[model samples]
Target: MQKATGQDGGEAAVVGTDGTGPADASGLTGDGTGPLAGIVVADLSRVLAGPYCTMLLADLGATVIKVESPGGDDTRTWRPPVHGDMSTYFMSANRNKHSIALDMKDPEQLELVHRIVGEADVLVENFKPGGLAKYGLDADSVAERWPHLVHASITGFGTAAGAHLPGYDMLVQGVSGFMSLTGETDGPPQKGGVAMMDVMTGLHCAVAILAALREREGSGRGQHVELNLFMTALSGLVNQTSAYVAGGAVPRRMGNDHPSLFPYGPFACRDTDLIISVGNDRQFARLAEVLGMPELAQDEKFATMSARNENRDELRALMVGRLGERDAQQWQDELVEVGVPCAPILGVDEGIAYAEKLGLDPVADAGGVPTVRHPVDYSRTPARHVKAPPHLDEDREAVLAWLEGRGADCEG
Candidate 1:
């Protein structure tokens, strides 16, 4: 049923010929297996982190009402990567939800947001600290009015301290010590290619919201859950941060190398790169044999983990010499068959294609567009998608109709 879309270039929503929802929408599920079908979410957040969180909730089966301004979310203007003039950046995270554009400065529009919030089981926002005060939509005010609503506040920092700082991902990465430990040791600190901080923060926010939802069921009350970009970045550093805090070992940039794990990085083969992960001494021994240097396994300077750490350069030089005789894929096939952990370096598109070949089905067809499928696999209740991301204010009439209608479910 996927056909040519309208001028908006969003994924086509092919309902019945009459243009209503599908004939058999017993609930909100496309495949009739959504566990969170009854829950309504008023998504007042914009841009990556917030939208990503709401999109995940929508995939879990919440009816998400995305509130955008007159111009829509900022990512809508991020261009160059376009799908028929649509902002692929915006599409990346805003799927499986309905979008409504409103100007908060307009009293009437502000009332519409309030109406949506009144019915929402969860409210997510990433407004600057106190940015929504003019409209009385800030966390404290909204929480006071709707005591049962789970209010999630995503901020650059806490409300009281560092409130003036902007919550850009790169800045958070730099300040959180992520940049300091990335890239080559001799090179200047570099930010990651993707906005990992934003992604991590969004995931953390989603988990906290889900937890609050569980608590609400027991206590019949909702609490304010707050997460910030910098804090998430700090926690995301994981073992690197632990080394500094617990072991007093300030980690430095080693490029693709792990500070303590030798032979656990990418190396050049005859034609391309293949990454090998030698986690333990056993794996190291197998690697030694694969390189046709079984005698190296008994060399006192390269036998054990500590020894490998001490002679990492010598070990790498020897392996590189051996790998130079075979192409990356050939070596990968041979090493993997023997239980060695390794893979040939692939581009993003190749990775997707490989996932498809492996039957992972990493992409979900929403309406007519393909989106990254939800990472979690629920055997009993699977994630479902009804439509694609909406164009700016494209569903305003339908949303307004639903809002004005006396439907407690907020199917608007």
Candidate 2:
């Protein structure tokens, strides 16, 4: 059923001739598996940051109702890697959820949203400062009405005196000093290869929500939890920032090399590169013996960790020279066998395969839709892949129908 969609966009829900969900829904699985099996999430955020967070919730068995704007989340059309007219960018973070489109500007739709918010156990929003208020869906106002709802907000900055500024992940990384510490210090500061700040913020938000839900067990009330990319980036640099604060040394980018450790980075082998972390003197000795250079461990310049750090350049050169006699994967296997923490640099595919071989379900079927597996695991109630990332408003009519039983007058 994959069709060619032009750059100009279209909505996600494919309405039947008589206006109901397809005779067979192509996307929605509704399997109800995993840890969050019975929870309901009202997702009112979009793009990577918000969508990623809500997607994590969806993966945990939450019935996530993705509230897209009438035009849909912008990434829905960010194509070139499109699948059946859906963008991979959209698919990357948005599996295991149902979509519902609404025009927030319309008063009737706003009323219906309030009804949905009322029934929601959790509500996640990433609207700009004061943007949701225009639609009467702000946290403070909504929480007042739904006392048990865990309302979570993802902002660029903390919602304080300075709330108007937009919160994009890259911008926060640039402004929060992450960019200054990335890449080479002498070279231009580079943004991370992926949207790491956003990823961290999403994870932080999920953690906060889970904590709030635990607290509500006794308190019998939900609290408003807020997370921003800036705060997440700052928190993620815990060790680095703590070192600077305590040691009075602002760390700069060292690239693949470890700043405080030697012989703990990528070294060129005969055919490839491998990373080896010699955590202690014992490990260093083991590594040296494995490389057939036992004398290097006793050498005055690299005897201790401090000495090795001081002579990092020389040690790296020696290690690389020895490593260059073997292939990266071969060195990896030997080092691992010898008890040194090591791995070869793997591309995405190789990484996935490696994870799979280790019995890690790196990928799983999202209701027959191929999707990456969820990161969380629970011993008691396992998360089930109930659904795949829904097409835009794929569940609109169905959701509306369900809402009818809730006794809320839906406006759409």
Candidate 3:
């Protein structure tokens, strides 16, 4: 494990007091390994949003104990593409956490869970509105007992007027107008291929938890944070949302093209499709030169961003004609060399390879399966080696032992 150093050469380290007390949980015990050295997380969320949030925390050196309700997270069985009998979707998110399959229905097991929560610094759950309250683990209930615990809740529509409504990424994409802004003008609305809304909401949850932890440093108290897919989707709509709110225009799907910018989309080359991002007039001018249509830059219909946007269809056809003369890679190289933002749309495998080649290390070997890597990088206290997502109930004994020791010391 490399020491994650900050820009100022300070080693980045976790600051929380692990339930096992200060000395034992601070850093690795003479073995020289560990990422999250002192933080404990009881992860109660399942599927994409909640799991992703905890995974991020785990990647950053938190000791995350994932609590599964017997059947195992539904994602564990969600597979057309399975490795080691594990769903790729589940593998993608639940890394660096010790899994504990407990039947919360059993009163004794439920009591154990309460004890675990009492010893944890953070608790993350994505149950539907009031779903966890019956089990005595909702934010208010848990925070009442564990005042220092940072409790995070993930919901689909949020805990407001829409709390009872179940939120799904595709549904939110549809209801929040994301789908309406995708696809071609005459085509059906298309949701994103990936569950991006869930992913984003997960990211938001992680961010909010970290902020709450920082606040706890001064206040010595924890906070309950709530994140929802609908709100997250709406916030992510960005330009589309702004257009509807301010301009009173319902945006339509424009397929592979920018709504406000010309030539800021994909064009078909001879062998493949290439995405070009001609952001401003200068880029457009450069694009014209690159395409052997330098004269087009001076044409009034395609001179400025506004003018080019107005005549985007015409400009797109012209660019496509010129672009079709060469292969995508060749065109991409030429455009990129001239400062035009462009790329040949690569598949997932190719994207992974590209990131690896650039030393980005997008995924890491967790336990045995490859897990997506955390995006943030620190200099002094660098992230540790990837740990595979745990098998169900894998670390219950060890986690319980650590907690019991801590509880005993607190009593002493």
The best candidate in terms of lDDT: 1
Residue 199, model 3: lDDT of 93
Q: List the candidates' TM-scores in order.
A: 0.90, 0.89, 0.90
Quick one: ranking by lDDT, best first? 1, 3, 2
Q: Write one digit per residue (lDDT tens) for candidate 1, span 3-57.
A: 2121112222222222234312322223323666556678999888899998988
Give me the overall lDDT of model 3: 0.78
Query: Per-residue lDDT for 212 in model 2?
Result: 85
Q: Compose the digit string of candidate 3's lDDT tens values, residues 132-243.
A: 9999888778777677778899999988899988877898998998998888889999989899999999999988998998898788678899889999999998888888
Cα error, residue 54 of model 1, in Å, equals 0.6
Q: Indicate whether candidate 1 or candidate 3 has the larger lDDT.
A: 1
Alpha-carbon shift of residue 293 in model 3 (angstroms): 1.4
Each candidate's clash count: 0, 10, 17
- Model 1: worst 10 consecutive residues (lDDT sum): 2-11
